[model samples]
Each structure stands twice: as C-alpha cells, then as structure tokens.
Target: MNPLVEVSHLEKHFEIRSGLWRTVSSHVRAVDDVSFAIAAGETLGLVGESGSGKSTVARLLLRLITATGGSVRLEGREVTTARPAEMKALRRKMGIVFQDPAASMNPRAKIKWSLRRPLVTNGFEHARIDDQILAMLAKVNLGPELLNRYPHQLSGGQQQRISVARALLLRPRLLVLDEPTSALDISVQAQVLNILLDLQEAFGLTYLFISHDLNVVRYVSDRVAIMYLGKLMEIGPVEAVLQAPRHPYTQGLAASSPPMSPHQRGRQRVLLAEQPPSLIDLPTGCRLHPRCPFRQTICEETRPELRELAPGHWAACHLAENLPAPQPRDT
Candidate 1:
C-alpha cells in the first residue's frame, strides 16, 4: 500500500548571517536529506535528543516552514511544489499538536473561540460550528462547561485536550503529535495518551509522533526512527530498533533509556565517547563518527547510506552487518 505521507530527501538549511553585510556566513543544517513515510493509521515515532531536527521535520511536513530541498507527498500529492490553493487544501488533511498546548492558544480568547477558529477559517458553517465543537470536545473527553473559560482557566491536560479537539475539528487524516504529553504530570500524561490512542482508533488516524522520550515513543509507536544530527541512524519495528538496535547511535540511545524490566537492569549500557558534532560545522562522512566507538578509517572518510539490515530494519552504519547483537539479552 502507498504511504499516507511520503517524504523524500527533504532538506531544510537555515542561513546564518553575520557582521554588517548580513551576507550568508554559513548554514545550520537543520534537516538534511531526510526521508521517511507514514502508512495509513500507523504511528511512526521520531526519537532523538533535543536538536535532532525532529520538531523541524514536523514543521516541514506541515509546510509551516519551507524546505531548502526535496519532496513531500501527502496521499501521493506533491506538497513541496504545490500552489497556495493546493497547499491550503492539503492543510485540511493534516493537523499538528504542539509541545505546549497553552502557548499554542490565544491566552485572551475564550475556549469556544479557540476551538471554533479552525472550523471558521476553513469555512465551516456558522450554524453547525457549535455542534461540531461540542462533538469534538466529547471525543477528547472534555465537556462544554470549559468552553466559556479562557485558556488560562483550564488545567494543562484540559488545554491539551482542547488543542487536540481543535486540530481534529477539520477531520484531518494525518496528525502530527509533537510531544503532546511531555508537559503534564505522569498521571495526566497517561490519561492524555490513553485518550489519544482511543481517538486514533476511533478516527483511524495516521500519526507522526515526535518526542525525545524513549519510553513514550516505545509505548505509542508502531515503528520507531532514531535520528542524530539531522540524519536517521536506524528505523524499524519498535522492538527491533529499541531492543536490538543496529546502529551505534541507536544502541547508545536504547542502552541509556531506563530499563524496561528489573531483570534487564544488569545489561551493559552503550555510551558514545564524545559529544554530538555542531550542526553548522558538521563533520564530513558520518555525522556521528566523532563519537562512534567502532569508527574505522572508512567510517571517518566516507558516509554510509541507509541499507536494509533485517527483514524490515534499516540502518545507516557501515559496521551494522559486522557488529555483534546488542544486549537485550545477557551476554
């Protein structure tokens, strides 16, 4: 089946200007040659530490920001080159829930107006707007009583639910969930996540779930992509990538995460020897080569493109085939 969303060689570089002239001094490679696809109703988790360009990828997919190069196709429609009208039409099929729900809303606006704004902008009928909003509110487990209150009046969880409702008001096919539960309390997080899952099942929604939290991704994602310095290191089934990580960077991430079980606490952890390279002055060859313990002369001098390593697993590492299996089991 064709992917609901397909991204190909997408690149976004931010130009840095300095001195009086403001001429382009350098470019921060925010996203470089990244590509992935999201199948219908499948949640693809994008995991990485801060500044791995996960959020940037989300914006690029939504056309919230322009990409420097490459293509994005939604339901096989080319998004990068679409005209304003075409792009506007495409916007209805996609919705984004940000990391901070309160900040995404207008603080002065009442919840009703905030919820109604999208439908109104999209030309939703005035008479039916209230009914639609109420229905959506019910779906997110929110009630109509809070509609009259301002954003400041709602709890973090409520605010987020409202955000979800607003995003789904248009009945978008794809939902970009950018750390939807990170800000709430652990209990609230669980509640919000359960609601999201319920809603996804109810709506048959396809998700691009982005978060730095490994545990959250593990819980919510069907397939997981591990990114480093604007590049994908490994991508595969959640268990394949997380439990038996192929790439060194992915191994480090899996090892560093809080162990899933008490028995697994004795497993040896993988750690990178150095820090991530600066994005503006990214090293040639492999971006993670500086910190990679298995780096050889070839690794330092040449970059490795993603290659199939297992039935459904892919990794961008030269040594992936030769590396011993990761310790999800006692060695």
Candidate 2:
C-alpha cells in the first residue's frame, strides 16, 4: 500500500542576519536531507533533543514553513509547491496539536467557540456546526458541559483534550502531535495518551508524533525515527530501535531513558563525553562523532548515509557493524 505521507530529501535553513546592513552572516541548518514516510494508520514517532529539528520537520510536512529544498507528498499529491487554494483544500486532511494547549487556544473564547471555529472556517453549514462539534468532543471523551468554559478555566488535561477535539473537528486523516502531553502532569499525560490511541483507532488516523520523551515515543509509536543536528540518525520498528539501537546517538538516548521496570535496571548505559555540535557551525563528516564513544578515523573523514542494518532497521554510523548490539528490552 502507498504511504499516506512521503517526505524526501527535505532541507530547511534559516539565514542569520547581522551588523547594520543586515547581511546574511550565517545559516542554521535546521533540517538537512531528512526523509521518511508514514503509512496509513501508522504512528511514526520522531524523537530527538531540543533543536534537533523534529518540530521543524512537522512544520515542513504541513507546509506551514516552505522548505529550502526537497519534496513533501500527501496522499500521492505533491504539497511542496501547492498553490494557496490547493493548500486550503488540503487542510481538511491534516491537523496539528501543539505542545502547550493553553497557548494554542483563545483565552477569551469558550470551548464551544473554539471547536466551532474550524468547521465554520472550513465552510460547514452553521446549522450543523453544533452537531459536528459535539460528536468530535465525544471522541475525545469531553462533554458539552465544558463548552462554555474558557481555556484558563480548564485544567491542563482538559485543555489538551479540548485541543484534540478542536483538531478532530475537521476530521483530519493525519495529526502532527508536537509534544502534546509535555505540559501536563504525569497522571494526566497517561490519560491524554490513551485518548489519542483511542481516537486514532476510531478515526483510522495516521500520526507524526514528535517528542523528546523517548519512553512516550516507545509506548505510542509503531516505528521510531531518531534525529540529531537536523539529520536522521536511526529509524526502524520501535522495538528494534528502542530495544536494540544501531546508531550511537540512539543507543545513548535509549540507555538514558528511565527504566520502565525493575528488571531493566541493570542494562548497560552509553554516555557521551562531549556536548552536541552547533548547528550553525556543524562539524564535517559525522555530526555525532564528537560525542560518540565508538568514533574512528573513518567517522571523522566521511559521513555515513543511513543504510539498512536489518530487514527494516536503518542507521547512519560508520562503526554500526562493529559496535556491540544493544541488549534487548521487553516489549
């Protein structure tokens, strides 16, 4: 089956202006030659530290920001250079849930208005807007009673549920969840996650879930992609990437994650001695080599392209073959 979303050779660079003349001094390579695909009804979790370009990837996929190069296709239609009218029409198939729910919504507008706005903007009949809003709310386990409340009146979890309701109001096929639960408490996070899973199952939704939380990604993702310094470091089935990571950066992330159970306590951990390289002045060759424990002379001289290590697993590391296999974790 064809993938629902396809991104190829995507690149985005922001020019930094300096001095009185405002000449372009340097460029921050936010996302460089990144590629991935999300199949129908699949959740592709993108995990990386802050400034790793995960959020930038989401924006590029949605065309909120134009890419400097490469292409993005949605449902077989090229969206990279789509006209305004074409993009407006494509909005129905894609929705985004930002990290901060309170900030995403209007402070003065009640939940009812917030939910109704999308449908109204999309040209839904005024008479049927209420019915549509209520149905979408039901999918997120929210009731009509909270519709009159302002964003500040609701708890973080309630606000996020409202955000989800608003996103679903358009009945989108793909949802880009950018750290959707990062602002909520741990208890509330679980509730929101469960709701997301239920909604995906009910709506046959595909997701590009972006987060720095590896444990959360592992829990919700079918496949996981690890990124660093705007490049894809590793990607594969979540179990394969998390349990037996191939790239050094991925292994470090997995090892540093808090163990889910007591039995995982004794697992070996990989720690990097150096800090992450700067995006503005990225190092030549392998970006992670400065901090990678398994760095070699070849690593410093050439950048390794992502190559398949197993049937579906891929990693971009010069010493991927020589590194010891990561211990398998219970799925």
Candidate 3:
C-alpha cells in the first residue's frame, strides 16, 4: 500500500520587503523544495535548528499557510491547493499538537470544554461528546476531576497532555507534532512520549514529529530526516543514520547528542561556526558548504541532489557517497 501522506517537491517561499518604497524585497526561502512520505503506523522525525523550515512544512501540510509551490497529498488526495470547503471536510482525519499547548488552548475555556470542542465542530453526536471527552482525557493520563480546570489551572505537562487529548479526539490517522515536548520538563517529556507511543499502537497512527532535540528524535522516531537552510540534507532509518551518519551536517548533529549510556563517554560535539547563510541569497551551490568543514571545490559550485548512497539510505552531499569508515565497535 502507498504511504498515508505524500509531500512531493513541497516548497513555501516568502518575499521579504525592506527599506523606503518597500519595492526592494528579497524572498526568504523558508522551505526550499523538500519532499518526504509518512507511512501508516510509522513515525518520521524531522530535525533541524530554528529557521530550517520544519514548522513551515507542518503548516503547509495543514494548509494553515499557503504554499508558494509543490504539492501535499493526504491519502493520495491533493491538499496544497485544496479549496476551503474541501480542506475543512478533510481535516477531521488530520490533527496537529502544537509546541506551546498553553498558547494553543483558549485561556477561558475549561479543559473538558476544550477537549470536546473539536468533536462539537466536527458534528459529533451530542450524547457521545461527554463520553468521548472522558475517554480522550483518559488516553492522555488526564481525568474527569480536572475537567473543570482552565488552561491556567493546569500544570505545563498537564496542559500539554490536554493538547494531546484534544488532537486525538478527532481520531486523526495523521498527526503533525511540532516540538510537542520541548516546553515540558525532561520527566514530563518521557511521560508524554510514552503516552504517544501507547496511543500510536492503539490507533495505528502515523506521525511527523518535528523537533530541535536530537535525543528526542532518537527516542521517538523510526526514521529521521535532517534539514538545513530549508533543504533536506539527509534521511534514513533512525538507527543506521544516527549510528553511522554519512553527511557532515548529519554527523555533526549526531556527534552533538550527549551520550545516553554512562560507559560511552568523552564524545566531542562538532559545532559549526556562524548561522546558516541568508536564505534570500543562499550560497550559490550547496547551502551548507559555506560553513562545512569538509568543503571542497565541487561543493562550492554544485548543489547535490538527494540521492541513495546505499540501500534505503539517502543524503544530499557529494561526500556522502564516500564517507569515512565508522569507528570500530567495542564488541
């Protein structure tokens, strides 16, 4: 069967206008052409620093913001250019869990009311709304006793859990989680992740988990995609790609993740200098080449297309094809 969601060649550009007449506008290449698919019952983590366009991809998929180019297809149906009515009808099976749950919720509304609001909007049976709310709340480790509390009454973790319950109320098969755990404490993050895992199994859900945390990506994802300067630099299965990173950018990121095991110590992180080049006037060739320590003459003149370097593994770097051997394991 085909992937549940297919985003092919999706691009979202912004025109930045500045100075005097405002005619001198330079475009911000927010999401320069990017593409990937999400399989049913699988989680694909999208990782990058701020402004790498991960959130832009999510908003584009939901049509919260219009895309300047490319197509977003859900269940093989086009969404990039979907009409208002069609988009609304299509949204019942799709949901997003925002990073800042407190901000996402209506401060005045009680948790129970907020959780069931989606059901009410989707025209769920009135008799079923209460039961649905309770069941959804239970799934997120929330209870009926807290139902009367407003967003401000709940703790940060509880608020985030409420956000999760609200999104799940729609029974959406596809979930776009944008930094869902970043705002919570570490302990809370684990709880939320576990809850998500249990819920995914129960519902056979597909996820597009976006975050700046590599450790979180390592924990929650089956596969990972690395983005840089609005472009995808590498993508592969989580274990193979993370353990044996190919691209310099990807390796740098992997190396930076703190050692989870006590025995694996003294790992040095590869920190890059300066911010990514301006998106408006990105480097002529490889966008990452300017800061890339492995920069070569060819990297300065050519943009590497994302291609398979090995079976089921792809990276968009000239050196990806000839990466150095992995350090020996302590077998």
Candidate 4:
C-alpha cells in the first residue's frame, strides 16, 4: 500500500541577517536533506535533543511553513506547492495538537465555544454543531459540563483532551502530535497516551508523534527515527532501533534513557562529549563526528548516507557494521 505521508530530501534553511541594512550573512540549516514516510494508521516517532529540528519537520509536513527544498506528498497529493485554497481543504484532512494545550486554546473562551469554531468555520449547520461537539467530547472521555468552563478552569490533561477533540472533530486522516503528553503528570500522561491509541484504532488515524522522551516514544511508536543536527541518524522498527541501535548517536540516546527494568541497569552507557555543532557553522563531514566516541579519520573527512543494514532498518554511519550491538533495554 502507498504511504499516507511521504517526505523526501526535505530542507529548510533560515537566513541570518546582520548589520544596519540587515543583509543575509548566513543560513541556519534547520532541516537538511531529511527523508521519511508514514503509512496509514502507523505512528512514526521522531526522537532527538531540544534543537534537533524534530518540530520543524512536523511543521514542514503540515505545510505550516514552506520548505526550502524537497517534496512532501500526502496520500499521493503533492503538498509542498499546494495553493492556499488547496491547503485550506487539506487542513480538514490533517490536524495538529501542539505541546502546550493551554496556549493553543484561548483563555477567555469557553471550551464549547473553542470546540465549535472548527465546525462553524467548516459550515456545519447551526442545529448539528452542539451535537457534534458533544459527540467529540464523549470520544475523548470529556463531559458536557466541562465545556461551559474557560481553559484556565480545566486541568492540564483536560485541556489536552479538548485539543485532541478539536483535532478529531474534523475527522482528519493524519495528526501531528508534538510532545502531546510532556506537559502532564505521569498518571495523566498514560491516560492521554491510551486515549490517543484508542482514537487511532477507532478512527484509523496516522500519526507523526514527536517527543524527547525515549520511553514514551517506545510505547507509542511503531517505528522510531533518531535525528541529530538537522539530519536523521537512524530509523527503523521501534524495538530494533531502541534495543540494538546502530548509529553512535542513537546508541548514546538509548544508553542515556532511564532503564525500565533491573536487568537493563547493568548495561554500559555511551556518554557523548561536547555541545552540538551550530547549524550556521556545521562540521565539515558527519555532523555528529565531533562528539562521537568511536569516530575515525574517515568520519571527519566524509559523510555517510543512510544505508540499510538489516531488514527494514537503516543507519547513517560508516562503521555501523563494526560497532557492537547496543545493550538491550526493556520496551
């Protein structure tokens, strides 16, 4: 089957300006030559450090911002060059739940009013708007009483649920969940995650789940993509990538993650040194070479393209084959 979302050689660069005239001095390579796809009903987790450009990738996929170079197709339709009208139509088919639910919502507006905006803007009939809003709330396990309150009155989890409900109100084919549960308590996070899983199963929703938390990503993703300095270092089945990571960067991430079980506690850790390279002045060769513990001379002189090393698994490291298997961790 064809993929629901396909991205190829995606690139996004922001021009840096300086001086009184504000001339373009350099460019920050926010997303550089990234590529990946998501099949229908599949969740592809994007994991990386704070400045890894994960969120930029999400925005690019949604056409929330224009790409500097590359193609993004949604269900065989080219989205990168879609016109305003076309994009407006596409918005109904795709939704995004941002990291901060409270900020995404209006503090002054009641929940019911906020939820009704999409239906109203989409031309829902006056008589059916309330019914639709109520139905969506029920699906997210929210009650009608909560709808009368402002966003400030709702708990963090409830606000997030409202955000999810708003996204699903349009019945989108795909959803970009940007750190959805990060703002919630642990118990609340589980509830929200379960709600997302149940919603996906019921609605056949495809997801681009982005998070820095490895354990959360492992639990929610079918496949995981490891990113660094605006590039994808590794990507594959969640179990394979997390348990036997190939790229040195990915291995470090796995080792740094908190072990879920006692058996994993004995595993050796791979600690990286030095700060990430600046996007404006990226390293000459492989971006991670400066901090990579196993780096060789070739690593500093040449960059390696992503290559498949195992069935359906790919990594962008010249010495991936020679590196020892990543210590196993509970998933």
Instruction: Compose the digit string of candidate 3's lDDT tens values, residues 1-331.
Output: 3589998888988877788888747788899889888888899999886789999999998888999889989988888777878888667778999999999999998887788788888889999899988888888888799899888988989998888888889898898999999889989999999999999999999999998777788889999999998999889898777778778777766655442223322342333555678888899778888878778888999999998877767899888767676442221
lDDT of each: 0.88, 0.88, 0.84, 0.90
lDDT against true structure, model 1: 0.88
Residue lDDT tens for model 4, 136-177? 899999999998999999999999999999999989999999
lDDT of 2 by residue, 123-158 (tens): 899999998888888888888899999999999999
**Clashing residue pairs, backbone N/CA/C < 3 A, model 4:** none
**TM-score of model 2 vs. true structure:** 0.95
Q: Residue 73, candidate 3: how far off, in angstroms? A: 0.6
* TM-scores vs. true structure, each candidate: 0.95, 0.95, 0.93, 0.95
How should the candidates be ordered by lDDT, best one leading?
4, 1, 2, 3
- Clash numbers, per candidate: 0, 0, 0, 0
Model 4 Cα displacement at 316 (Å)?
0.5
Q: Per-residue lDDT of 206-273 in model 1, one digit per residue for the tens?
A: 99998776788888999999889999888999988888899988887777545323454344234576
True-structure RMSD for candidate 3: 3.1
Measured by TM-score, how close is model 3 to the native structure?
0.93
